[model samples]
Target: MPVIKDTFGYLQDDRRVDRITLSHPRSGFSVEILEYGARIRAINFPHARRGPVNTVLSYASLREYELDTAALGAIIGRCANRTVARAHPEFQLSCNDGPNHLHGGLIGFGRSLWRAVACVDGGSPGVLLELQSPDGDEGYRGNVSVQMEVRLDSPLSFRTVVTATTDRATPLNLTLHPYFNLTGDPDVSIDDHELRLAAATYLPVSQDQIPTGEIRAVDGTPLDFRQRTPIGARIHETDGGYDHYCPLLPGSAVAAELSSRRSGIRLSVSTNQRGIQFYSGNSLAGATPRMFRARVGLCLEPHGFPNALNEPTFPSIMVQPGETYRHDTRYLFAMTQD
Candidate 1:
């Protein structure tokens, strides 16, 4: 396993972006990342029979969306979810209340430039992208340091590990936002895809799309995806389509699984987070007409409770001084003929 670095591309605004490539020869898998927030740019999985490699997502096209700072396939953090407008004594964070603080304030880890530190662990290849933010960078107190590791274990698995430390007490929630397309067809809608989430209840949101702090049962609701079902089956029944956080049932370790019946592609998501956000990409305003429609691509964001800062009863997002914040999420890919 070897870690290699190279210059990727610079935004028109004159920000430098670097690329890291990690390869696992045994598994015939490789991954590339852009140094901007250490975002995952592309993953290549060799066919089972040693055929041409199949790309999971459009890595190059992602740059186009970078114009708006979409943070595509980047590690988001400081606070992964929304925070209400107010101050919490324990966490020492102030919420604007105007809208929930999303993805670590507006300029989250995704938008920040990270220092690339290339390293290999034993025989495993990976790179650690580090960023240190001064206190109040995003209206949060305390200086925060974040390290994001992108590892290529096999062609089938890409692991993301995020760890952070703060000098003063603050709120911390972090997660990766990867836009996946198993079929490699960006224009194809995932409506026909089947998904199963290991959850019984979900947090409902208000008209403004902020969590109402109420945990509602998923049974008999469009939010239910406990069993395998087509993504588009109940999408229209909901507001613009699913965007709420699904709370996993007790003892459920496997957060969710998605499969493309046509491509025989399967992705199993494992996480320690308390909630999983099933975003149906309802807000995808693509530039081209051939781009997939809303609800075409789905996001299974493993994270802490959404709007946690506003709801006192929810899991605490506090990160105190001298304490380290850590979260691990894995997306394992496999192929089946079913």
Candidate 2:
């Protein structure tokens, strides 16, 4: 295993951006990351039928990635999801999504540059990226330093660990946003992918797509994926496509499982977070011709609940001085016969 580093592109300010690749020759598993947003450029894995296929949605050039609004394969931070307007009287943030804040405001971590370096973790090739957010960034109260390590844990598995520390109390939730197309083809939608999640309850949303602070059982609703089911099975039943949060059930180390029959590729998701956000890529609009349609990919985000700052009943996303916040998530891939 060797780590390769190259110049991706230059910013408008002429700052050099780098691209790092970690590859396992034997298993033919590779991951490409960019320093611009600490984003994942691509995840290439061996397919049963195809020689090697990229499992995540990616743009053609750095400019396309810079203009990406869907986040694509980037790291979202400061606050991963929406934080409703007026959520807190003391904390006022810039509203990017309608009247509420989405994915840490307009110039959030996902849109910022990070310093990255190649590293070795447990004899595995990895990249360590760090970003420093100044005080009053996006109207937050603290100067925060965050470190994210993307490691190739095994031939077919990759893991991410994010740790942060703030000088003042701040609402912090970071997660990697990667649109997965298990079929490895942008023309093929994820509608046929079979998915099962370890969730018994899900948070209901309001007309604005913000959580209503009510937790409902998924037993009879279309949100229920306790059993393996096709993504398109009950997608039409939702307002748009699935863009809800499911609280992970306890006692299980695994959070979700997704498989594509066309490529015979399966993905297992595991995380230490309390819940997972399942997005069906309903709003995706890619510059590529084959990726112009929605539902071409989907996202599984592991982090704290959305609008948790306003919901007292929900888990806290607050990080105080001297306290370190850490989140670990892993993605494992395999080839399945059926």
Candidate 3:
């Protein structure tokens, strides 16, 4: 177990941006992260066939990330997804996503500076990143102290735990937005990637991407990822690719399983959260250096329902003053024998 610190780059005015690399030699697993946005710069997992693969989509330099608008490999906070207008009348959030506020508005946690510290525990090699949001920061109520701990457990496992404490009762949701392409090649499309989600129902969204009140079944629609299906099989059936929130049922708690046949890599996602949002990089154009193109990667975000604050029926994301918001998610990776 080794925790290595390096000067990644400077954000502005000689502001030293630091990065930490945690490696588990025995497992051949490593993760490099930057303090600027508490973003995961790269994830190296040893696949039986591929040797080592960077599972998440990211840029080679900090400059590209500073200019990145796609929210690549970053920690999203305040609220994870789009928040409806007047969702909470007291808040005036930045309307970056049409009339809705997207990913915590303008200065979201995904684009903020976080304090970093090295941690080498008996369990895993990791880093602890912390950030403080002011009372009225990003039009959210209450001052919040947020901490995200990223750990690499073994050969091909990454775990994250996000905790937040607010001074007052407020709606809060946090998620890691990581675009994953198991091919170990960014130039390839994920069209052939097969996926199965442990979901029987999904929340539909409006034209503006705000979640509708209706929770629809996946049995009849193309949203049915209940069975193993190639992503390209029904991608054309949907209007804007896969961008809906699928709520996990009692027996469907594993969340999702994605595999790329060409790479012989399989990813099983497990999380305690009730919902997972699957996005097929439909809106990406030139977001990254080489690996950024439509259908190149997919994001399986495990968290609470989007727009839950507006829809009372959806699981509440309220973090009380005395309570700490906690979320844990793990991605288990393996390579199938050919």
Candidate 4:
């Protein structure tokens, strides 16, 4: 199917926003993307009874999207996750999350407008969104240019390839923040959803949610999803819910798998990143539009270790001059008999 473009709405600054639709005819699977944040507005998957159900949490209008704090289906950049505040003396990173950096500061890349162009890859429909971040824009060094190529690779499957280059040495980690409910019904929670991770160990965090520099095994812990298990089976044992990073075991192409028996929808995530952040939508209780509830959706973000800038033991996220940073991830949706 051809990509359809339409007006989404206008920003408070009077800037016009656009939405792009990429559809696959054979599977009746489609994706809608808003140019405002390069966000995935919706992922309509074919259902036996419902026809096409939006399996991802999204806002009703552009206004609600502008007021979004949950990240929704947006692309996070500059650095995907958290970083310790005041750790880097030379780089005065903006502290948006209570003296700590969260999701690339207050107005991160997810909140910025990106230039979109229609494109096709190997006969697959897609779009290319580009953004330029000047040095010191987010208290980071170097002017970085990023390009995200989103393509519908096959029936019920899509892929994203993000590439960036910096003029000076700077920390760069980018990831997509999409909340999935599988059931496609806002009134439903993902408590019964089955999940599995390709991780044998995970990073333990302190009270501030920063990694404590220890790579611990998931065995004997609720974080263990080495085998498929219910999401809420042991959620109560944690402080709130799962919000830790699990390092992906080497040679594992599939990072995570999620499925909902209620909807018979299954989602598999594959990425080249080293870890995945499993956020069970702990803070979705206060989200806007009144349709949100805690645990109604979950986020599986694949990126580098958080606070890598502060932890010498963690792998570095720095990209030197003339070096191009690249990260690729794929999402496949299918129906399950069970």
- Candidate 4: tens digits of C-alpha lDDT, residues 83-199: 986788778899998989899888889899987865663347899989899999779999999999888999789999999999999999888999999999977888899999999
lDDT by residue for model 2 over 123-197, one digit each (tens)?
478989999999999888899999999988898999999999999999998888999998888878999999999
| Candidate 3 C-alpha lDDT tens digits along 156-191 | 687888899999888788888888898878778888
Residue 222 displacement in candidate 4 (angstroms): 0.4
Off by more than 4 A, model 1:
49-65, 86-98, 121-123, 286-292
**Model 1 lDDT at residue 11:** 68
Report every candidate's CA lDDT: 0.73, 0.88, 0.84, 0.90
Q: Which ten residues in a row have the lowest lDDT in candidate 4?
A: 115-124
Supply the TM-score for candidate 1. Answer: 0.89
Question: All candidates' TM-scores?
Answer: 0.89, 0.96, 0.95, 0.97
When 1 and 3 are scored with lDDT, the better candidate is 3
Write down the worst ten-residue block by lDDT for model 3.
284-293
Candidate 1 lDDT, 165-203, residue by residue in tens: 999877777877776666666677878888899999998
Steric collisions counted per model: 4, 0, 0, 0
* Native-to-model Cα distance after best TM-score fit, residue 272 in candidate 4, in Å: 0.4
Scored against the true structure, residue 3 in model 4 reaches a CA lDDT of 80
Superior by lDDT: candidate 1 or candidate 2: 2
RMSD of model 4 against the true structure: 1.2
Cα RMSD of all models vs. native, in order, equals 3.0, 1.6, 1.7, 1.2
